[model samples]
Target: MSTLLLLCNQKTVSDTLTDVLRSVGHTVIVAEDVFSLRTKTAKEDPDAVIIDLPYVDALFEDIKRMSPRLPVLCWMQES
Candidate 1:
């Protein structure tokens, strides 16, 4: 099973995604914001990351710097 870090502030979304991923036999870590996401990424060493936020270019760059081979999935919310 792969470990995925989900960076999302919305409780409902985070909870749903976590449940789905876990049901599929994947491990998931949820981070409520960029700071915690970064910290968790470094600490957990997840296989991939899913981000739902605005202005995520810098975060993507930072993740690449931390783990170049890491896969990232980004979703933007409608304002």
Candidate 2:
């Protein structure tokens, strides 16, 4: 399995995802923000990223500014 990076500010969500991925035998890394995402990418070079997109509209510019495109899994919190 490939390495997956889960980027989410919600600790429970990210931690749960990590547990599931690891259970399936994929290595997982969790990052809480764009900065941590970059830092983890530098170290781990994951094959994919999962992010919560609740505020992605505000983050679009920054995401686009990133050098390379990464596969992303998007989610939102329900109220």
Candidate 3:
């Protein structure tokens, strides 16, 4: 029963994962773009962050700086 911050730009990907995650009892908060990432991280203080995107090199550093202790899990899409 933990809250998870989900950062996904694709609508389909976000919707699918959000449903699955919620079914398992996790409270999922979503951020479609980088602009919302900072706000969500500060406001939600989620147990972990799930980045569902093809590229995350630019975001890894930002997430670390915001919440270094928080767990970050990346979900790479198949090509």
Candidate 4:
């Protein structure tokens, strides 16, 4: 199983996803904001990440600089 870091501000969405991932055996760490996201990403060095936010372009670039090899899955809302 992989350690997955999840960055999502929406409480309901984050909670539901966390439960689902944990049930499947992956260790999921949640970060509700940018500061925590960077802190956890640097400290935890998760195998992958899931970004579910309204704006992710800048954050996505920032994360890449921190961990170029880390895989990212971005969740965008339909307009």
In angstroms, give how far residue 11 of model 3 lies from its true place. Answer: 1.2
Clashes of each: 0, 0, 0, 0
Per residue, candidate 3 scores C-alpha lDDT tens digits across 1-79 of 9999999878888999899999999999998688787789888899998897667866777888988999888867877
Best by TM-score: 4
Residues 1-79 of candidate 1: C-alpha lDDT, one tens digit per residue: 9999998768888899999999999999889788999999999999999998786788999999999999999888786
List the lowest-lDDT window of 10 residues for candidate 3.
Answer: 52-61
How are the candidates ranked when ordered by TM-score, highest leading? 4, 1, 3, 2
Error of 3 at 36 (Å): 0.4
Q: What is the TM-score of each candidate against the true structure?
A: 0.91, 0.75, 0.89, 0.93
What residue pairs clash in candidate 1, if any at all? none
Where is model 4 more than 4 Å wrong at Cα?
none
Model 3's alpha-carbon lDDT is 0.86
Point out where model 1 deviates above 4 Å. Answer: none
Q: How do the residues 30-74 of candidate 2 rate in per-residue lDDT, one tens digit apiece?
A: 887778876776677778777785775545445435525766666
Cα RMSD to the true fold for all candidates = 1.1, 2.3, 1.3, 1.1
**Candidate 3 ranges with C-alpha deviation above 4 Å:** none
Assess each prediction's global lDDT (C-alpha) against the native.
Answer: 0.91, 0.73, 0.86, 0.91
